[model samples]
Target: QLEPLPALTPEFLCVLNDVCVKCYTDFAPDELEVSVREHILQDLEGFVRRQFSGARLRLFGSSKNGFGFRQSDLDICMVLDGQDTMDDIDCITIIESLARLLKKHPDLKNILPITTAKVPIVKFYHVRTGLEGDISLYNTLALHNTHLLATYGAFDNRVKILCYVMKVFAKVCDIGDASRGSLSSYAYTLMVLFFLQQRNPPVIPVLQEIYDAQKKPEVLVDGWNVYFYDDLKTLPSRWSEYGGNTESVGELWLGLLRFYTEDFDFREHVICIRQRARLTTFNKQWTSKYIVIEDPFDLNHNLGAGLSRKMTNFIMKAFINGRTVFGTPIKVLSPIYPNQVE
Candidate 1:
């Protein structure tokens, strides 16, 4: 016999329930959507099976995460079971076969765009319906750790750390406390990119070098203190550090924007608000400050929760209708950015 689940607090669960409702309502792919998705998956699997026996498929992102909405697209990764010499031509054959089958269903074909890459990646998108999916072919060695990509032949630790951190942070943001709505995963990704780009001389060049070498590259955090010594001879002790008092986290965030992006205006895009609100006994402060909002929504006035008088005043002056960023028109569905990460 099993025991019943414990009842949750009405306050927390209510917000979560609202998120679940909005999530499904906004993005849950419908029956017809599922049909199309399954069709693509089955056809690709069949094609691969015929050519390369014992291959397996794994799906990731929104489709596998259960956050998928009605119109959500598909993301699939194909793992090869054994050592098989598959050239770019072989990968194309697999994709072309599937594309031919999809051609029979005009609706699916119209919305789906299929393109293959050197690493056996077939990206499909349906422009009309916004349904998209991907087919990735990978060897067992690379498949063992999907978090870090062995792109062009190198294993990078930064990718694994960044992905892991982003995932955890995004999960924290998803709670959607009315006081803190939710930060979209896409927005969080942009923030990560911005931070990485701020690294002196840029990190992408280092990644490119590592990729060409086909080996894992060790990253050293500049301006950090050495906390631990992993080994004496091979790699130096890892260091950790932070910006001193004169510079706040807000300042660091601003530096990231100014250093990396070519055309974005940091001040025009972000608003910092410190609010005084009755804090929960469990929380950190009796009064706290959050990013609260960004881009179009003034953190102070438009937002409903934990609003301070100063925030209300600041918002009125800073925000106006019809402001745009990166060519996307601004709308305050939430505090986070709506479109692609810059």
Candidate 2:
């Protein structure tokens, strides 16, 4: 018979809460910073509009999802109104044109036009705010993803708090950059959401599962059904069966760490928050990846597809270390250092 894990004592919970609160305060961007970023985006939008008529820019990722940290890069998506598909408009041509346009702006520095990249984007730095941002054309999937994350964050403040804390922790341990064969902050947030959804008396409902049979909302994005109950007001009545989870942010944070470190089988399972059930990696044909996280909209896109074996081990080690620090009891104060000799 397996042994049940010990519960976190109240004393330890208090300490974890204090640390999380401090981390949240220290890492979260202030209102002034947000205001400045919005202004910069507005200016960029105006410039884009001058060249591409009917083109509109929208913010996504951490900037709009409420999970951004101080000085985090902003993600913007540009949607050209008349273009139904990528074939309709040459993405590389438009991106190159936009890059050249942005280069004219003195405030926009280090402008790089990456047309051949997977998600072709125009990366640039804003001189005034010293903030970096990438503009991708017709990335509507990212827009939906941002909305999904925002909804989750709004459902429980703890979700946002834990996400911010985890992001900072990943950055500190140097395992958060996706370009370097690790997971992105967005992927980390999904992992946190998956853990929360699987918790006993789950902190959140599988939003995609909450809807009436006759009146279900249909949202088909990029050939995938990305439908989910987004209205916060109606969610309470729809998900009345599951009462509020009384777990503290600290407890959930620790639980998240423990879940990733001990319970989750990265090779066999797929992290899918869209449904309230386990998805197998074999079924998805994602068995080869060390960490498989299904993209909510683009089912075929594994967020962790870029992770190599060594990077997976590094990430797992970080998780183990995190669990050890947050899941176990620690001495509040070490023995006082010996008095220095005069």
Candidate 3:
């Protein structure tokens, strides 16, 4: 059993809030940095078009998502002008050729084609800007996912702060690199959104669950519905619970740590953001994984499906330690992690 937490003093809560806000201010990229990514994308598209004339690229992931850091990657999704989709074999073939094509470019180096990943990508390093990027073919679902996350991040300022804090925490704990056998920064962002949606008098509404007609509208992408209530101008009227929960960013950050470690039932429930109702692990037939995070649009995809037994334990322990460190009322708190809790 986890040890009981002490009552949080108001002064410490103030400190916690400051730390959460600082996470965003310190890590977020400025406008000039954002424009450099766009320039890179434009230049890459022009270069790739020399070989594949119809190639069109658009930035997604943290690049387009609101909760991006200065050093975050450029997730570019490439699609053909005439063709709508490509089979796995076609994708791999294109990626392999793309790698060779990129290697010939003067500015790009380390052109590796990762055909084994769920989405095949041609990874490259932009020498001038020192930014790493990957181009995936027909990543339509990811484009939608980026929009969904951006919508949430724009809905509330507090949401963005908490997500930044969560991502920072995950990176500090060495549990946010999906390429390194852990969850991605995207997964951590989804977890923050799920917690906010599940909070009492929810901080944010379930975007996918809100609709006008008797039935929800369908916006299909890659055979999955990508529709959500994105009209933020009138969201106050649409979501009855809008602006209901006015908790500070610091409180929400600590609450999120506690929610995952103490309240969330990893064995029984799945971290789903598409709807407000709790989804069971058994319902998804994903009882095999201890931490099941259902992709908002892609129902078959579980973000935590890649975690090993040891990694899951490691992730949980990090959260448990985070909960204890943040929950206790102490005179001094480390800026980020628990180890420096002086």
TM-score of 1: 0.34
Query: Per-residue lDDT tens digits of candidate 2, residues 49-166?
Result: 8888788888899998998877899899998887766742488888889999989988889999887778899999988788899999888888888999999999888888888888
Q: Which has the higher lDDT value, candidate number 1 or candidate number 3?
A: 3
Q: Write down the worst ten-residue block by lDDT for model 2.
A: 333-342
Provide C-alpha RMSD values for all models, in order.
Answer: 18.3, 3.8, 2.0
Per-residue lDDT of model 3, residues 1-342, tens digit only: 989888787878988898789999999999999999999999999999999999999999999988999889889999999998999999999999999999999999888999998899999999998899999999999999999999999999998999899999999999999988999998999999999999998999999999998999999888999999999998889988888898999889989988998899999999999989899999999999999999999999999999999999999999999998878766554454324443
Global Cα lDDT for candidate 3: 0.92
Q: In model 3, which runs have C-alpha deviations exceeding 4 angstroms? A: 332-342
lDDT score, candidate 2? 0.84
- Would you list the rank order by lDDT, best first? 3, 2, 1
TM-score of every candidate: 0.34, 0.92, 0.96
